[model samples]
Target: MKKTAQIFAGIRTPFYYYDMEILENTARQVKELAEKYRIDVHYATKANEDARIVSLLSEVGFGVDCVSGDEVKLALGCGVPVSKIMFAGVGKSDEEIFEAGIAGIGAINVESVQELYIVNAIAAKYGFVANVCVRVNPNIDAHTFRYVTSGLNTNKFGVSESEFPELVEMLAQCNNVKFRGLHFHIASQIKDIAKVTKTLCGVANRAVEWFAGHGFETEIINLGGGLGVNYENPYGDTFPDFEGWFKAIDENIVRKPGMTIHVEPGRALVAQCGDLITKVLFVKETEVKSFVVVDAGMNNLVRPAFYGAFHLIENLSAEERPSLPSNRVYDVVGPVCESSDTFGKGRQLPLTVRGDLMVVHSAGAYGQAMSMRYTLRPIAQVVYSDRINEAEKETPIL
Candidate 1:
């Protein structure tokens, strides 16, 4: 961080700084663990679709898990093989289905029985057989945020257990759609391993057996990724518990012969490697509260305003002033118009002043991907740690 801080000193603020070393280390760890457990790991493209990140993960032997036609095309353009791409979503348009069919990529995870017929019709029109996997609602609470929980019966993400018979009958009729296996995605930011090993795996195992009994052979079991990262302490234990996660699956999941286990991890692979670097614009002191306003707004990073998520905030410039007391508390806010544009309230830090650099840690997952031009704020630019010297030469110091 000290070395990277020097680079940030010269560059403009309100940009995303990616630590390549951290990303590479995390990716290598995930790959090693996945290979050890004989699991097919797919990089969830929705996490951070930066071409460089996607290309790096693809080079590291991770497949791409896409939730849209554009993502599918993006994966293919990034040198990911067609056989390694998986398309999944609840509401896919006819045009998107046609794109996937024409691409002839890997399995399309069918969320509804109706989608199965649509995929079949699209494949038939395109003169190709579409491989599909039934996305089942395991009815297991992921113990995460309500907005991200998908495996519950109340969630509109996957087909419920009661709909399995109809789904099977529909699958039997869709000649252009070949049943590949079952897919289950519980939620995002799931910290409990028991939820996966004790609850999710059991539900999936029984579902696989039930399908087999109905004369439908299961070939792939895609346990969708919701592995959480340490948000409170980004620097400490920067990597997720990939070893424990794979071990749990290895010990608990019951896979049939010739079956493959797949995981679609998004945040776990890229979250820790990124930080939203912004400049402190003003230091406002009211009778009731103190606010450290920044140049970046909710348009730059919305996790705090949107999901009420937490990210470790650090005042980078204050590190150089050792004499300054590090005991002040203030609310860190952005320049956006909305009251919810606040990043962190009651944040403890050193005496932060105007022109100081501040960073929101662990923002690689949905940070840039979910950014918008709301209020016409310009999107943040990206800077890589490996190319800092070049950036220093080109970027004008503010």
Candidate 2:
């Protein structure tokens, strides 16, 4: 913390600080664990998509999982091979489909029947066989937040059982489409490993059997990544339990011969490696409560305002003092006009004053990726540890 504070002193506030060491370590662990089981791992691009991070993951031998056309192209720009990229999104545009077909991406996870037809048409136009995996709605309740759950029957993600038969029939008639396998993504931030693994195993096994009965062989079974991380205690559990996570899948999922397993991990891989550093602008004390207003707002990091998520708040300037030595409760907020732009309701911290730097922990995943120019605020700049340290040692912070 002291080293980071010195390295970033006088540079700028409201910026993202990425510890490259943590990110590389996380990637290494995920890769090592996935390789142990021969499981194919794809770094979900939606997680960070920072060119540097994507290039690092590409170098680490991890494929990328892109959601939209822009992300697909972004991954390509990051030098991820077309064969190492899998595009998955429910509402892909015609241009996106055409581009994916032209690029010959690894697999497009077809979410709906209409998308299937559209993809097939685009592939036919391009004279290329589109490799696609049918995203199945397993109806498994990941028991995660309602907003993030995608595998529920009511969600608009995958095709239902009744719709699957018709989709299979349509696939049989299409000359430009090749059936690769089935895809299942319950949701994001899933904490219950047993519940998710058991449910995924049941759905995948049944789906494989049903497809075989219809004279189809699945080459890949993608268990969409929804693994959760410890946001409340990011330092204690910096990395998600990848060993236990893969163990659950390997022991539960009934694999077919020559079948490949793929998982798209987003949050679990990148969430803990980043922190949002915002400077305290004003310490307002009112009759109602004390509010610490920071220059950063929801436009900078919206997880708190958008999802009511909790990120550990630390006053790096007060690291020398005992934890919350003052024992005073304060509402840490941002400059955004929205009432929901509150980071923590009643955060207990040490005596804080103007210009004190605060680090919002566990922000690497959705932090900058979801940032917007709302309220006409310029988005925060990102400062990487590896680069900033070297430069800071030679000169002053910029």
Candidate 3:
């Protein structure tokens, strides 16, 4: 991990470089802190559920937070037991619900009463009772990426807090479903406490305010993952201030000791630990604009194109990294056809060449998970610790 710059200096490009040491430490940090509060934390599988990544998280005593039936199967396949997995999504198909029922997952964070009914029917058919938590749209803004924002009232995600009483009545009237708790998700990449605290505060109040009466009690409060990472400077604070982050929950949320406060943290735990590596395919110097076309494309990392995201670009070949007024300014583009397929535009970095290798810093989460085969691009591969990637880094052109 420490030699990321030096190691990528000689290796092939267009692949993601994962820092195992950093990732291991991240898992330890999360597990240890979560243990302190005795809170149940499930790492969101949607972040980056590589087999090794999931296994490392499991070793640290984290549960699984999956958004789809496929992710649930991946978690279980990777040895994260169904007993410790939770499924939450707005559009789970009947087939997925039936599969979850048969698997008897730990809990299904149901987005609506209709979903709860479907899950219940599937459970009844499977001769099992499904545990479920209703996802409530807290209507709080996370102030992060608009594309990732999922908890607004306008976002077709969760049930309204106003409908909680009716939902409780319906749940009590049902026989096959076991009510678990209330689930709340504000938005993603939230850095402001005002947003998180307010969302959590709303969740806390609604738990006791909306459903606790009339024999309906809320158990788990699954705050869906959306913790914004330090894209501005990932290494500045390798890990987020857990104390401050948790303090937001502490000062804002009023959780009873008995209630299992669950957090679904995805990027905050892994973003700093990984970097995407790509070799410079060509350095075109046009009078209009300089372009650095890399071997890796939007197919390998789509956050830039899909969400207008930015990943710090690093010139691995530069012995002495950039110190502005950096003479270099290039549009670090990929091989994808669409103009939006670029990663960082007009970014300042050390001068690079066609053979020079580059690094896309802070791509641990939502990086490889979002890769696609668009434009017939072959998927990118990843290499573990720098030491392990040396010999095998010479990947053939795809």
Candidate 4:
């Protein structure tokens, strides 16, 4: 990124920079591995949803995993096939369900028995059978953040084991809803393979057998994506363990004849390829600590404020001034009014100063996608690596 900093110097501050080559390579890796394991991959559109990123992944033959009607439309607009789109969300509105039924996407992951009835009713009203998958809450702990854990009984995501009988009865009665298979997503940012191979796989197998006993044959096991990326050291292994993840599923999952396995990965595919570039606006020194304030704020990248997440931060202009101390501890903060607008605390970097370029790594997944106009801040512009020179010529320096 130091080499790229030269190009960034001429552009405006607080913008998202995406490395399309890295995204392409990561997409290719996922495609090759999915093919090797004969697993269908649907890129979770909620991760980034940038037109360039989505279009590239679509061209790579990866389907889309949508959670909203707008997201489904966005994926379709990005050239993703309607047959390749899978819609999953707990609170899908009636309009959304009607749209999905009309569009005839691959499958709609139903989270509750009541939702199954609703989907069936909507499909019946539209005179088309909606392909549906029951999202089961296996109650497995993925050991991730509390907000991201979705498989627990307490969470409001999927159907619990107690609802199996009701779900089976409902599926039997719903003529307009075609039972495709099952869906299980324990949590997001799952780094442990045991969570998938041992915990999730075991529950899914039992659920499939239970459903089959009740006259529903499982066709697709959509393992919702939670594969984690290396946020601590993204530069080391930029890619997530797609190979290991697929291998584990291939070995552990008990696939029935003519049944297909599917995965919906979001962060693992796009996180490493992007960075949030911000220029230090002030270097404030207090009695006990030092702070490096940047123009970017929680509205720009909310992971730090929302999830208490970490992204590797670096001073890209450090090498230019060798006279400065190599080790300097300071709190990296944003200019937002809220006290939670901090990026990192007690971070060690080369003596940072005003005008120094700072890069936040592993932000491609949730950074720009989750950004808002909170505090009335203008949304940051995106600059792709392949078009850096063009962006530099177009964007005037602040």
Which pairs clash in the backbone of model 1?
A: none
Question: What would the per-residue lDDT of candidate 2 be over residues 206-308, giving only the tens digit for each residue?
Answer: 9989988886789989998988999989988989988877888898788889999998999898999899988899999999999999988999899998899
| Residue-by-residue lDDT tens digits, candidate 1, 1-398 | 44335667767668888889999989998899899999999999999989999999999999989998899989999999999999999999999888887778889999998999889988888788988899999998888899888888888988999999999888878889889999999999989865465688888899999999888999999999999999999888789998888888888899789999999989999999999998899999999999999998999899999999999999988888979999999999999999999999999999999988898999999999999999999988888888765553325445
TM-score of 1: 0.97
Question: Against the true structure, whose lDDT is highest?
Answer: 4
Model 2 has a clash total of 0
lDDT of 3 by residue, 1-398 (tens): 46445665556556767888898887887777777766688889898978888888887888988899999899888888787899999999988887876788888888987887778777777788888888888777777677778877889998887777677777876677888787777777888845576567666665655677667676787776776788878779778866566656656766765778788888888888878888888999999999999999988888888889878887776645555235689999998889998999998877777677788889988998988898788767777884464535564565
- Provide the overall lDDT of each model, using Cα atoms, as 2-decimal numbers: 0.89, 0.88, 0.79, 0.90
- 2 or 4, which is superior by lDDT? 4
Error (Å) of candidate 2 at residue 297 is 0.7
Which portions of model 3 miss their true places by more than 4 Å? Answer: 4-6, 9-12, 320-326, 386-398
Q: Candidate 4 on 1-398: residue-level lDDT in tens?
A: 33445777867778999999899998998899899999999999899989999999999999999999999999989989998999999999999999988889899999999999999999998799999999988999888899999888889999998999999999999999999999988889987955455678888989999999999999999888999888999889789888888988888889999999999999999999999999899999999999999999999999999999999999989877879898999999999998899999999999998888999999999999999999799788899988876664334455
